[model samples]
Target chain A: MIRSEQIEPCAAAEHSGAWARRHVLDIEDFSVPEIELVMQTTSAMKEILSRPLKKVPALRGKTVVTLFYEASTRTRGSFEMAAKHLSADVVNMTAQASSVTKGESLINTLNTIEAIGADIIIMRHPLSGAHYCAAPHVKANLVNAGDGWHAHPTQALLDLYTILNRKGRIAGLKVVIVGDVKHSRVAHSNIWCLTKMGANVVVCGPPTLLPEGLKTAQLLFPGIGVETNIEKAVKDADVVMELRLQKERMQSGLLPGLRDFIAGYQLDSKRLALTKPDSIVMHPGPVNEDVELAADVLHGGRSVVNDQVTNGVAVRMAILYLLAGSREQ
Target chain B: MPSKVVITSDEMRRSIARMAHEIVERNKSTENLLLVGMRTRGVPLAKRLAANIATFEKIPVTVGALDFTLYRDDLNQRQPSVKGTDIPGTIDGKAVVLVDDVLFTGRSARAAMDALIDLGRPEVIQLAVLVDRGHRELPIRADYVGKNIPSSKDEDVQVKLAETDGMDEVRVASQE
Candidate 1:
């Protein structure tokens, strides 16, 4: 549950005049207070998740269409569960079964879903900014589940919620993001959100996997640190977030082999000892199990990996409830 | 615009004390009695009642806060400012006294009741309000009310409890 005392009342009659932003394109679109609002909403939604019935009719009759151009297991399941828990009708669309294979354009597909009376579109595409380009093409609200490597906002928000729920605050905490920093959309989104919430973020990876636009990250959220040394990056960190190593990056010669990557950066109990005793481990999972992380450490007491998965549903519920649940529509 | 003070601090305290005693008398005992307050103003009022019940019967009454922002019918018309909904323990077979500040169209009460039901199937759910203002759109009614004030549609009944507003008074003022 939320610390109601910590959140300013939902001054709906005052500052939320019109509350008309219908799409969640990226974390960059939200201010710190807005992010807090989402967190507070998620906390309330979590109570519903823990209920005996575990369902709320808040989104009754609302249609949430989840369109994923890329294959996913966790993100897709979480969104579907979140929508169903809120009593919204869910229609899942995938790239393989859809007419995209028959040459239907992205905008055409989105319009087709909108034409079928979908109220909201949650899309994850293989191309960066795919959701951005599709937003103006449909009347239904658009949620960027993930856009190539540009942003996987809900994942990041849920990660933040998980951290805040465990630690009680975000400001002044050191959060080290480890693994495929160059290709992991989860890492990109986390850096933007954690930094916005006043957490010091250090992105650590093998030099080949580190982004050439590292300067852009520092520019995006000033004071962001880039580190190649795993030990230095995690030292004194309040949180260590491990990203799943995309094995495809190996074929491209980003690293010599899985052994090299694991030896250099894979987080195990021994490596975890380098951080503060209370430091928590997190993963945006479908873990590379024992590759990017030691299987034992990922499931250890200090790991909030399972909590992240549970909070994923609550956080996505908040996103759908806020973006789709409105009387005016 | 001049506002009328319907209930003063002393009278409000006496009304709450009377309500507490009535609750004890009606329930026959404080055993398995839970007081659930709606968020914002209802929380403090519920706590006050629990405190008064403890003093009167020398027994502790469990108090919890419920936030109905997510359960409201008007979610589409406005942004919901969510609050904490914390029920200390299960109310499966207990008598729940749902507390709120004012009863107007009865929508908030209905929403809170809906939320409470989802949490657990309480043995019996009863609502208590400080002010029972006129013009309830729903057929809902409060089980215990401090005062019943006939009000016009445009008039807002404002209940100020010392815990939230730093004063104990009920005021009737025009919405304008």
Candidate 2:
């Protein structure tokens, strides 16, 4: 386990003002260097945030656009706060307000953001691979905040930061991601980050949401297992991440009802009982009352859902700070 | 901090030769023996020791690396970051030597021992160090010490070897 005593926070990697060309869309496929680059940079950003006057000039004089066509308060606000902390200007574009509401197509809006001297665009859209489709069209660096069920790279990164901070190491860890595995971008992104860092992973959910034919997780790690039993999946787990079931899950007919989903997949104190003693509980919130997690568990000692939210600012700060400072290896 | 003109690379080579001779003479053979380096610098030192022993006895030597970051109890005292424990080989019933550069805080040595226990129990264990600047907090002692130069606690000793950082030098900088 990671010891949290007297640790002099690491200084951010010396940004030579040459690191402004990087972009993060998915954590599943990030190389070890890329991951470390983010981790090391995040370490320094965390230290910076600990100060009273928390803002930095690392990302000053740059344009960071938050393009979210999905409902999110934590993710969007964290990005806004992080960019603000780094002294960068922010532009928020949701489908509700943007020309995207008038059928302006993803490409046109992305192109417009590009033409407006936008230095960066942080996006979260409901449509799968929408960011990938807009990646080529946008001239500025694109950060996929949450792109449908495909991947939420930054969320996974923040989750990893939580684990690394609490546990101190990533290798040989047993991480179990529970609930809505099929439609969870957090679970998907975690499969890549945890596996890449040499942690054994198990994705467990109800049979309907946890399907077969996951090629990305398997392609990166051929030995990963996908299970359905919450008990068997979470046994001896060092870290267990519970994902919130999107409202679309029921509309998609994958879940029968909320009562049944909670009975099977909810991580209450009883379900949390099955995990390792020192295990930490995590969630990407707006948690369903009794579906994905219980109220007590979310507020209890093990829950890092709140910490996960706070770390989002730190992680994003690291990403932008690193990308803004140096593009050199 | 004393300006100790620490051992040169040639001096290092001779000390390793002597240490290698002592290890072989005491054990009578390399059987059940393994050299495990304690991270960045000790790893190469173990390789060199293994190489020297192989040359002396015409028998193969098993070399492994043990990173102590995970086992450290001082992380909470210092900095919160991820430093992993990577053990590339097994340590079942073997005689092990924990190799390191500077044995100052002794916390790192203590952590290395804890990490080794998780890997497997060794029949016998010993310590080897390139430098042992005595400001011991724990009751640990190095079994094989290349150089024992006493120094103040504020001094930082960095060892660079040609195999790793393209040069062999020991610099003692004042702690910031």
Candidate 3:
């Protein structure tokens, strides 16, 4: 439970530019209090979302532009709905329909959006650091929706919020993340957020799919555990987050075949029993049925994948509300 | 430097009991009565009032909590964050009684009214404060006041309830 009064909207407006950060570029840039603020604020937003008329005037007169240069369904749709729910005027822009299809540069299009009076820009691009590169060239508050394999911060926030709501706490929880750990921006962001929040994060995958930098995760967090054995990784865990396997990883030779990946790492009912009895299962979906997880386990009582999606709106609303307040100042 | 007790425990109880009876008398019938408290201190007071009313009228009364952070006009000066807003049922055609600890500038009551209107159109919205300290900055006044204490800007009125703060008392302390 969060008191909306804890956020000083008046204090924010008193100073012309009072917010600590102008943009939400990465989870790596956020401190513990900032993350907690987002999580706490999200709880309040979730309450508002549950109302019969699920809309708030928090972002009234504010404009949020979601610009996607990549193909997506859930993320784009959720961002649009979250912004609209907050009463912010939203403009959805995809690469195919926008000037980017005609070879317009990323920075140029972003600047044009700023010139068009977009108070904030939510961007998803193919190249990593797309948000980082575009931040300097625009005045609008830049939110990195999902930039290549770099970060999907709002997704991570929702995942954290979901876990917090279910578990009642994040500290000291054993969260075993299993799948293509190498290229998953979801995994990367989760690792940063979980470890920062004091959760014991264990990343498990084939040695090839495990990113080389993941080994150093323990350097930053002594409790961070990396395992190649799925059974060992999930044993006594409080949560098991299964990552989506990209077909591109197989084409790039990181995995042998879909059959081999399923044989080695598929989260079926049998594998779920290895974790704690009350352990919840999660997947950053567009789930590959029978690939990342068995269909039964995915739809089972222990699954919170749908809750993750439902929470996505609340989490994004918190981000937009916080950023929109700052951008107004 | 020392604080003075304005309303003792027994007196606080009697005041709330009286307010409950007054609420029932004015509304004519207990039907469709919803008590909504402003967050922090106001919540327990509203619950107390609801409990007192239920005891007297032998009827059910709905109690809810409203967080007016989004509706506040002074967000730039104070950072607010706490619990979520929970309304028990539809407020349409129901008489909503907004409750709080102390009424000062009347800004909080104003904000609560704004939030209540957004939820649904109520038959009538009324303000009830445990203590009313005169210095209203807005064109708003409380309909029900337990006690009206004339005080300067240099004094603060604080209410403590056993449910939230482990005691039941009201005190006026000097700001300095």
For B1-176, candidate 3 gives per-residue lDDT tens digits of 66899999999999999999989998999898999999878899999999999999899899988988777776545445635687776889999999999999988888889888878889999899999999999999988999998889989888899987899998888966
Q: Taking the candidates in order, what DockQ does each have?
A: 0.48, 0.02, 0.28
Q: Estimate each model's TM-score.
A: 0.95, 0.63, 0.88
- Which candidate tops DockQ? 1
User: What's the ranking of the predictions by lDDT, best on top?
Assistant: 1, 3, 2
- Residue-level error in angstroms, candidate 1, position A221: 2.9
Candidate ranking (TM-score, best to worst): 1, 3, 2
Candidate topping TM-score: 1
lDDT tens digits by residue: candidate 1, A1-329: 21232333344422333345688889877776678778878887887777768888788899999999999989999999999998999999999999999999999998999899899889999999988888777788899989888899999999999998888888999999998888888998898899888999999999998889998767877889999999899999999999988888889888899899999999999889999899999999888889978988987899999999999998999889888744334
What is model 1's C-alpha RMSD?
2.3
Chain A only TM-scores, each candidate in turn? 0.94, 0.90, 0.93
Interface RMSD of each: 4.0, 13.8, 6.9
Residue lDDT tens for model 3, A85-110: 88889999989999987899999999
* Quality class of the docking in candidate 2, CAPRI style: incorrect
* Share of native interface contacts recovered by each model: 0.46, 0.00, 0.27
TM-score of chain B of 3: 0.97
